[model samples]
Target: MASNRRAFLAATAVAALAAAPASAAPADPLETTARPRPTTARAALAELLAGNRRYATGGSRHPDEGLLHRHALAAGQHPFAVVIGCIDSRVPPELVFDQGLGDLICIRTAGQVLDEAVLASIQYGVQELHVPLVLVLGHERCGAVAATLDHLRTGAPVPGHLELLVDEIAPAALRTRHLPGDWAEHTMRANTVWVRDAIRADSAFAAATVTAARFDLDTGLISVLP
Candidate 1:
């Protein structure tokens, strides 16, 4: 009789505990944190292009640059795209796309060349960050392409590590030589396309959408290439 009473008391306590409201468990860190941006590659591409259009029209919204957004991103980043662009001062990816902080993972090199470091950065954006889109952006009258063309035409050696840049861009210059446009412009577009194709072919970037475009200096317009 004593054991039965003890068992009954234990059952009552357990039932009461079960019936009691779950004291809202401390908020889970992962659940409480800001959710990542939900976007598809096509959507991300469209958003970027729209931002570029706004910037070109002098109507940039400059979204997500405020204090609250910055603080939220301090906890974690959820950029939607990875932009591989030139190191040109005139062609800042953030400004050109009119995107604000945490909008893009930008990887820049002269002529947008992809060495091991650049490739690894891009892979991180695609594989880890899950950025939906990768954009290879080149600009008109790119000095890198021009220098490569000059070097190819003159066979003169470029000084120091600058020659590395010329070497990387030379293939594109050579490939576009027979095309019927201004050499620099043709090579610029070709270089963008070449890099885009290279990124697209990477197994690491297989899940991400990759594309190329050229930024027009005079018009401030970005033209997506075929």
Candidate 2:
């Protein structure tokens, strides 16, 4: 009987937490009075960068994650941008960029490595969903980048399909191996730039503007690479 009561109390507490309001600002962009959807590439980039600023500065509004917003997204979704990032737990694009449901179309991989299916999904988002910005996010101290570098030094084969990732990233790792700064950082940035440029060259996404950026795990900031 005591255990039953404890479970009941826990359930009630969860319900109460869900019922609480997230913020005063209205959530849905589809609503007439709410903010309009981003239509241009530059505007989408600005919104994403601003969201990152909010996250890094401890001012994240946590927009569009409420119950009503979830309900609003059930009928349809029109996200403004697409983020291709690593599969690292700390670098979730939605949380790091401070966006909520329906704000971004995110695709995560072990090293942001590309396959035909990945390219197809991105093309579909730009052509069908009308998302204008495609940001490829690499990060500092990436294990994937490190692993690729290790393979370059040791020449040992990786296990399973992990070898595919090493193969894809090897070119960038090789290209930047002799550069001045940290080889890992150079490879990470170079890999991001290569992915962005590859997408631009292979895709005819007129509305989509591809960019490369690196996430700093320590500072929680994302810097665009030149």
Candidate 3:
């Protein structure tokens, strides 16, 4: 079943990519007011990594996301990057990465699963907001991952509607079952890598932006995949 879903996802991505405008084709949408400029993808990625490093080392320079910041962003926003992270309260992208309002376009889902809503949010980030980078942030000891691991090992279906999230993550969890160290932690990292690849392989956004980085919660460090 997992394999079938993966194939379905891959095919969907291909179709979306085929429909997207070619990268080389010239046609910039007309913009009113001053054009909203975004940082280069690499630069924006670096900033996020640096902030996460600070968070890990107890040296975080927290962003001021106060009332003034909110008001300034109400009329318009030009976030530099998009972060599709888990719904885990501990993994809030703004606080963990020390970013202010209008700094990041964030989308959260349980297990960081990609559904239509999440994909649309990502599309809006790249095509409309001109965000240069997108980060699929996943953390250690994720409850969703833990649940999936249980489902894989014990053959016990995740209870109730939670099965949907576990089902999405079970493939990645099963792949890492033989790896060294704690299985839960291993599964967590594997889940992060899997989600990262899912975004990179997406048809529409892959060509528009580089999909190449993951942040590990345990180390509070960013790992760039070649």
lDDT of each: 0.88, 0.89, 0.76
Local accuracy of candidate 1 as per-residue lDDT tens digits, 64-146: 67655777788998899999999999999999998888889999999999899999999999989888899999999888988
> Candidates 1 and 3: which is better by TM-score?
1
Model 1 steric clash pairs: none
- The candidate scoring highest on TM-score is 2
RMSD of each: 14.2, 6.8, 21.3
Which ranges of candidate 1 are over 4 A from the true structure? 1-38
Ranking by TM-score: 2, 1, 3
Model 2 lDDT at residue 50: 88
- Clashes (backbone N, CA, C under 3 Å), per candidate, total 0, 0, 0
- Scored by lDDT, the top model is 2
Which residue pairs overlap in candidate 2's backbone? none
The runs of at least 3 residues in candidate 3 whose Cα sits more than 4 Å from the true structure, single-residue gaps closed, are 1-38, 64-68, 210-219
The regions of model 2 sitting more than 4 angstroms off are 1-33
**What's model 2's overall lDDT?**
0.89
